[model samples]
Target chain A: MIVWLILGAAVMGFLRRVDLYDAFSEGAKEGLKSAVRIIPGLAAILTALRILQASGLMEALQRLLVPLAEALGLPGGAAPLLLIRPLSGSASLAVLEDILKRFGPDSVTGLAASAMMGSGETVLYTCAVYLSAAGIRRTRYVIPVSLAGWLAGCAVVGLFFR
Target chain B: MSAALFLMIVCGVIYAACTGRIAAVEQAVLEAGQEAARTAWRLAGGFAFFGGVIGILEKAGAVRGLVRMIRRPLRALFGRDTGQEALEAISLNLSANMLGLGNAATPMGMRAARLLSAEGGGQPSAALCLLLVINATSVQLMPTGVIALRSAAGSAMPAAILWPSLIASAASTGVGVLLCKLLERGGR
Candidate 1:
């Protein structure tokens, strides 16, 4: 990735007489601005995730969903993560950490969690925010398709595990 | 988001009170908030570094070449029916997501969303759905951050998850695009 990026920059810089330092600074500034834009939404999602988990609701939901997960052929341990992952990225990361710490990072369940986390997104969170940016409030056909893709990823993750 | 935010707070509070776990809930909320803030800080740093690199690439006009490279896949996945501006935005958006520059991807996505919504005449178009799904389930070329997490957890092969993740992401993106095409053909 670095090779390709730098090669592109080098070629383009030579041809375009680009000032690399100025461009770098400009992009860095945009990065900071984007970070600030996401903070409020991130804070709210993360805090809610904690409340759900601490209030015992998350656990109860886990127990309730475990059977469904097993019925769907996934390890029961991965059920909570599949549910939480759609809601918040940091929240899912938190769940992924707990799974790793509890099951050992090299274990099958841990591997499954890692694969799922690396593959999917904070679906509901992403859809909600992105659609809002377009000023389109109703997310018709978006959520279902997104979640379907997520489920396909989970199923494939199951397949790759020993 | 409004509904989700409302429900999360309401249900979290009521459920905690009902379960007599308000104390635990309070602590958890505080900790989660702090953790998320830390995550944001970490992401900001990552974004700053990569963003600078991208800045150089963009200013050098290399970004347009990169965008052109992915235009074929964008057309295939999004269909030829979508407009040029939206298609260009989707390609760049996917490229950012592929690099795991998600913080960068969001702002890029907003730009894409604006272009797409305008093209769709202020509604959710099938192409727009595809764009969102692709962004959400982007097949990672390098999951540097997740690999770092595995290393921190004392894994012997930190990069072991890389291939499995790619396979999973491929399956997800494949299914997402197929569904989008069908949804579009179904005339919704």
Candidate 2:
């Protein structure tokens, strides 16, 4: 997929009499800079998340969210996945696997969990990385809006599989 | 974000201290920093490759072609006049996301975010928020990763999730976009 995109862009650049080499190098320079600039923010997010996970705070948070998950029409078992989904993709995947193992894959809880996992992005991580990369400190409703969307997706999973 | 970071660390330390998991938390912090570095390295390659391709497209005037194609819908969605380059970046990112090209998507999306934020005078504009909302809502046409995982786990119907996933993501994206539009107006 990416190979084709590159080929197409190259062909277009050639046809348009553009300096592909220079353009690519110039753009890549900026891209690298952006990547480097976000390392500090990324470290902070990762450390916070890891600490939360290792300290069992995430588990405690999950326990706290169980009633809310049930209220949202998801299984209480899905609370852990829901709580961790926005913070870490790999952690959420681990939770999904646990769900599939504990509840058979075809069961309501497993199916609902899988459906939710399959549908959403890591909201908090994405927002943090993007905003930090842009040097924008104040998110200004981005977090609330993105989390709302994530919750909406989770809610739809209950309604869809029900 | 500063507040969030502060709270996360402080809460984590207190929790660890209370639970006698201080050593685990310390290890996690040290490991997390290394993991973050590794992740940044992996992402830098994607950013450079995709950014280079986009740069070539921009130079070739193909970005202009792209902007013209999606201009009307995007204009209505963003409700503002943004530059052609910015629109092109936005479309590229969204397309990459829809295609489930995550490695490609992040770099493009970040580029688009940077451009849109720059246009908004370093604040996240409505367009920027909409971009993020759409991304977070999962607009992928295919959930290949889930299907593969299901198949690996010996599921009878690994692909059964395709439609449900699509529908759920679509519903969320719709709601997200609507809220962004409403909030944009409300903010003004």
Which prediction has the highest DockQ against the true structure? 2
Question: What's the TM for model 2?
Answer: 0.91
Candidate 2 positional error at A108, Å: 2.4
Q: A1-162, model 2: which lDDT tens digit per residue? A: 777888999899999999989999987887787678668878889999999889988889889998888777888777787778877888888888888888867777777888888888887778877777666877777767777877888787878665
Residue range B129-156, candidate 2, lDDT tens digits? 8888888778899988877777777778
Query: Once model 2 is optimally superposed onto the true structure by TM-score, how far is the C-alpha of residue B97 displaced, in angstroms?
Result: 1.2
Q: Estimated TM-score per prediction?
A: 0.83, 0.91
Please give, as one word, the docking class of candidate 2. Answer: medium
Whole-model Cα lDDT per candidate? Answer: 0.75, 0.81
- Candidate 2 backbone collisions, by pair: none
In CAPRI terms, model 1 is classed as medium
Instruction: Give lDDT for model 2.
Output: 0.81
